[model samples]
Target: MEKPSPSRRAFLGLSAASLAGLSGCLGSLSTETDETPGGNTSDTDPNDGNETDSDNETHEEPTEPPGLPEGGAVMFVYDDGPMEDYTQALPAHRTFDAPATVGIVSEWIGREDYQSSGCMDIEHLEELVDAGWEIASHTSEHTTLGTFELVEDAAPGAERIYPEEIRHGYHRGKTIELTSDEHTFTRAVADYGSDDTGGYIAVDEPIEEACLAGETIIRYPAEKIREAMGDSKHALEGMGFEVETLLAPYDNFDDYSRKFASEYYSGVANARHGKRVNDPEGFDPYRTRRDYFIEYTDRESVKRDLDEIAERGALGVLGAHTFKEEVTEDRIRETLSWVDEREITVMTLREAIARYADR
Candidate 1:
């Protein structure tokens, strides 16, 4: 991985004047039309009440319209708080005056061992927050929030231990089911423990029947999911960044995760996939969709999605792993340029939700 050179930090100062000029141009464009590009009136009539207002009466200055552009909006979300976000992505976004949101894996920040692998430190993230970016929770340790199959079988009443190390998903007070080819047993986890070998779930009730190890373990118990959500938020907030969104690890989440997300976050990016854009009206903040920018992402397909979002006046959320080889700074710049040409507003996920989503 390439580290940020001193030259890049110097370049940021040089870009400010150009960014100011770009802002001016956009401001002028917004004021040119009485109605916005989406055909909604930008300002309301001040004297429509009587239909016979006196000429001397003072009219209230038209308040600036909402921050979202009528044409459409796009939110750039970078998952995993990697140093590249500060080193590579930030400078490119600065060139375009575009603000983004970054999902942070709480435990990874500032660990020296992880830094070699490109994990960002607290200072790096603080800079992003200062640069108009929003910090979002990716959960502690980047734990998988979705359900997975059990690797071992459990005898009646014994602690259910798995073959693989469990990073998360089990917590006291949450119910889990052990299902096999023939039997399914529901039990509340009385205790949860993990070690170098694997994770174990303790249940007060003895299993009346044995369950096959090859089958699924259903969903992650709810309390543990909440702990992941809440702990990440608290960890980030303790560092003084306001966290109001979640980008579930692996784009994996279910009703249990989504339900818990509402308690901690204002919106969720990568809440679910397969949808390109979110409807501006009545969009579910907890169910917001995202398209990933990956090694095999087709640039043309991305452009088409942006075009559709602009044409429909909907919201588009794009996710990326900035540390990857395929996600170069130049690629990020090119994408931002396309968004700029279409007159689409690039904002943080929180801003997009506040301006567009129902919640």
Candidate 2:
């Protein structure tokens, strides 16, 4: 079976593509409309209801909207941190003098499978940093944080392990990690099933019969979430990169994950697929948005997405994968060409996030 790519979902409201589908998604371009739920970016402080600055006085909101570098800002973000980026994607971006933020799976770096699968190694990631591309953590192994239905032991002090650190079991003879708390488990019970909607889940009682069923854990607990975040950030920092951003694998994260991310990352790239266009002046530093780029996405779709960003003066964050069969050189070149024609400014995630400081 072919491998699966990331799924699309909304961040705070409708996705950018879905918003585009709406009759008046961009009607009047009113900055007054708060698209994100409970996100009042006007006079409200992002930190909390306490809008007072350090001086114990109210901070004034900027009268003018924040501006992009030139025409507009278009940020291309590549996921899974594939090595082909060094050989292929990077060259294409350099062709247009564009910059991108590559989400790195820290565990995949220098691994045998990563090497064979064309995932980028540490040196390649370093080279990307040298070349001015921003490197963000795509989690330690691109592990989806909260998508598992693990059979657990209800007994206190049961065998517990971090979800991302899980290393055993098989779903239909495939190695399954991030699921049930199966410390000694090498294979799932007979009822393991996966489908188009749900990725993988236990479908029968056989899994429970094998052991006293514990509370079903979703994503990593708070501690484990912290460990994973710290591990990935440290791993990249060990490679000499000033890491401060995280791109959640599959763009999936729980509230706990977001909390821990703020401790380690300056910003996290967690957003809806089509609704990634964000205005820097009204930027949310923690819950940054992003868009997806698949092989099937046509040039018109790309142009339309960029055009939406340009028109709104929002920072368009486009995402892609390097090692997939669909991520071809020609496609990358084509996307770069679109960005070039639009005169969009290409910057790393760090550079983009810095604008929020002045805002």
Candidate 3:
């Protein structure tokens, strides 16, 4: 089930303080670690990179894509932890001997009636966690980690979310201004580490008026997404759920995002547009340690990704919003067929964590 909720303000304050300490050592923070892939989950690095490593140097080791055990090892993961996720996604997991993990927006569990939309319900959520799907954090709300990609993902001009009015001229009616999701989020992210100079807010709150005056792709809103991360970690752990994976809200990430995703969650899954911005594994865009980007778009694609999982020897994560209109009930069923094929071992994020930890 759910654990006692922490005070949001308190958690935010603490997280900022912690991040600050990291910034102090930021100069020497980027030093390379002896992190290596393969060798089971044992090789999974725990850096979540939550701390500031700006000063340390980074080194990339030449590694072949990781391959799974003999046949192939795959882990299925779902995001948002919504009730529909519990209702629709979990059954497929059970049929296949595969365990799953669902990341959640702590605050969105039950406020279904909120003016601003939220995520799942508590009872069904409890049922899923009790049944074995790993429950991880997606922040207090479904906020993006760092600035989101403004170019293709989001439409230009003031990303409008709600369309209500508050005596301030139709909150977002008839006016699509050019803005980034830098601070905008369904749920805000917990800005961890010691840097507290910038508090959290909507993706485009910290006005760079001069720079962002005209039409320009908005920046990813990492600050709000990372708010209360420490408290969130505590909450998840307290709920008897291990903090294991992170889903970049809409796969919105950047250099700093990768660092924290590595530091806080065991793995992170983002959309693989297949476009290498700088380099796939570069600071701007990198290989996700948690699992492979999902390919559950179709049954054939599912099979292809599964084969790739085996070929890579890395984990293949199955992701869905349960809310996506595109991923229908039928497609979900078709996707699970591959999980049952026995070619891959199905596991939850927690199970993956345990397996890796054991290794």
Alpha carbon lDDT of each predicted model: 0.71, 0.59, 0.45
TM-score of 1: 0.69
Flag the better candidate by lDDT, 2 or 3: 2
Tens-digit per-residue lDDT, 17-55, candidate 1? 243343444443443332222233223454674343467
Candidate 1, position 346, lDDT: 80
On TM-score, the stronger of 1 and 3 is: 1
Q: What's the C-alpha lDDT at position 178 in model 3?
A: 28
* Of candidates 3 and 1, the better by lDDT: 1
Models sorted by TM-score, best on top: 1, 2, 3
Candidate 1 — worst ten consecutive residues by lDDT sum?
8-17
Q: Residue by residue across 1-359, what tens digits does model 2's lDDT show? A: 01111211122112222322332432333332122222222454666866454566543322122224545676778888767788789898778766678888788876656634657777787777766678888877565544334443433332232222232222233323233454433223233333443333342222322334343444444555666678888988887877777788766765546667678876766644445577767676566777666554666777887887666666777788777777877788887777777767777676566544234
lDDT of 3 by residue, 1-359 (tens): 01112331222222222433433434232323212221222222467725335556444433221112444455555766655675567675555544566777776667676332445675667777666556767765455444322222223342222211111111222112324334322322222222132211233333233223232333333443345354566666766655655655555555656656655665554534332111111221134343223343345555676776655544555566666655455666666665455355555544333233212
* Per-structure clash totals for the candidates: 2, 6, 64
Alpha-carbon deviation at 60 in model 3, angstroms = 37
Candidate 3 ranges beyond 4 A from true positions: 1-68, 114-119, 148-209, 212-225, 271-286, 289-296, 311-314, 326-330, 353-359
TM-score of 3: 0.54
Q: What TM-score do all the candidates reach, one by one? A: 0.69, 0.64, 0.54
Q: Residue 151 deviation, candidate 3, in Å?
A: 6.9
> Best-fitting candidate, measured by lDDT?
1
Overall local distance difference test of candidate 3: 0.45
